[model samples]
Target: METHRIEELERKIQEYETIISEMSAPIIPSIVPQTILIPITGLIRAERFDKIRGNVLNFIHNKDIETAIIDLTDISGERIEDVCLEEIGRELHELASSISLMGVKALFVGMNPELVKRMVLDGIKLESQSFSTFQAALKYLMKQKGLEFRKISE
Candidate 1:
């Protein structure tokens, strides 16, 4: 049955494509327990937001992710005309609010400079604890949790 082999190959290809699609939006585990980092990068399309939100919410729902730090440092602005940064800002605020309602603290880090400038001019500000970098956010969380980094062996 050559047809059976062809069907199996098609199924495998579909699975691989789905995996690649999910991998496009990654969620990383942090050094601290109950914390995770989600770095938003590249041109985030409107349709992709639903998938992103679904994945993030699903992951958080499944695990004890107390704090979620979203890093936007790598978010590209090359396709500035294609999407509205203000809309994205609103979405980010909504996401943070939703995470908070779930008993999780959602922080932001490293917002793109261009985005910041645009949002400032547009009077769109995200109401979340934002830091300059991912490390800064991590340190802030660690301090809030009564933890600190120490060199036990150097």
Candidate 2:
């Protein structure tokens, strides 16, 4: 009787161990699609360029996002110093070139008065690279990919 009880207990323990092992098995993580939207804020300083670069790389690596919108709505309206404007233009040009090289599309939205003035003074012809608003930029970007824009009520 004692021997039988020992065997039964061992068997039960083994069964429980098996059940726990099965429950503890590693689970495969699910992949979810992510969208890329970056908003530029405040003064256009050199440090901000790093944020933009990091954000771009992060989207490319983590989200696999091909479309990005840089909104400059929060930027203050003031005359940009020539040196600062030059730096800003250089950064913009670099970002545009980088996105184009990576086969990604980038649209700069929110053309504030200060930005317009700086662009005019610097003779920076953004052409299709910049847009007046996020909605228009989105439409233009979608159009470039042969996609139709759907109107959403604000």
Candidate 3:
């Protein structure tokens, strides 16, 4: 009947939304061994934070990841206020703590300076090692592994 079709469509839409949400937070393994990078974009709501935490935990639990780089470069400071920034900072701190407990070093990269200042002004302390860019984090990891990169000319 019409009602049954509508219900099926609704269920499908919900399923798609869930899939999209999960895809938004991808845990990508870096070229360096035992390093995983998670690039976060868009507005990070409370629900999204939970999803991010769960996904990162689940993925790292199965992999031999010694370092996790959480990149927040794509998020703009103009889009979020100080209050929201504080909340997101707190969530990031929690995520970092959890990852540390699992024996993984969590490095936060690409944080907005303004937001970071605001968080600091609010007395929010971030325990994770932070870098201004993903490249910096990668370089640090490579150094830790005693690996060097040479530019190859085409």
Candidate 4:
């Protein structure tokens, strides 16, 4: 009886961890139609990246997302900072390519300048459309669709 209780507790703990991991990287819909924005933040481990990739791919497959904006501006944590920038860049590039193969345009935004410089130095070419900000990417996408936003006064 004691062993069974312990196993049940462990199983519950694993379930909670999976839920937290899923909550960490959320795929939000953008104002532009068929565009989804995924803001990646905090410590990025191999496991976390896997969760993000899986969730994004599942979301895209279910929805008619034409563009995916992967914003990495908030990817700054003590644990993540220790990881090699080159490795992260390579993984991101690979993810973009995978998304492209699925017929969705991947737009990487908010990349750190230092990281970008490192990628350039390492001769790692990004295959997706990159922008300095999410707004810029959204604006460009909206323009392509002949859509414009007008400011309204209260």
Q: Rank the candidates by lDDT, best first.
A: 3, 4, 1, 2
Error of 2 at 146 (Å): 5.7
* Better model by TM-score: candidate 1 vs candidate 2: 1
lDDT of 1 by residue, 18-51 (tens): 6865876689999988999988765677766677
List model 4 lDDT by residue over 54-138, tens digit each. 7888888857889999998786535475467777888898889888877899999988777787789888888888998988998
Model 3 residue pairs with clashes: none
TM-score of model 2 (CA atoms)? 0.58
Q: Report the number of the highest-lDDT candidate.
A: 3
lDDT of each: 0.81, 0.61, 0.86, 0.84
Q: Candidate 2, clashing residue pairs?
A: none
TM-score top scorer: 3
Number of residue pairs clashing in candidate 4, backbone atoms closer than 3 angstroms, sequence gap of 3 or more or interchain: 0
Q: Residue by residue across 29-121, what tens digits does model 3's lDDT show?
A: 899899999998765667788889999999989678999999988877654534377787788889999999899999999988877887898
Question: How close to the true structure is residue 99 of candidate 4, measured as C-alpha lDDT?
Answer: 85
Cα-based lDDT at residue 117, candidate 4: 78
Q: If scored against the real structure, what TM-score would every candidate get?
A: 0.82, 0.58, 0.91, 0.89
- lDDT (tens digit, per residue) of candidate 2 on 33-138: 2235566654455654655675566447644566667676666545232347656766777776676566666677786776578867887755336788877766
After aligning candidate 2 to the native by TM-score, how far in Å is the CA of 119 from where it should be?
Answer: 2.1
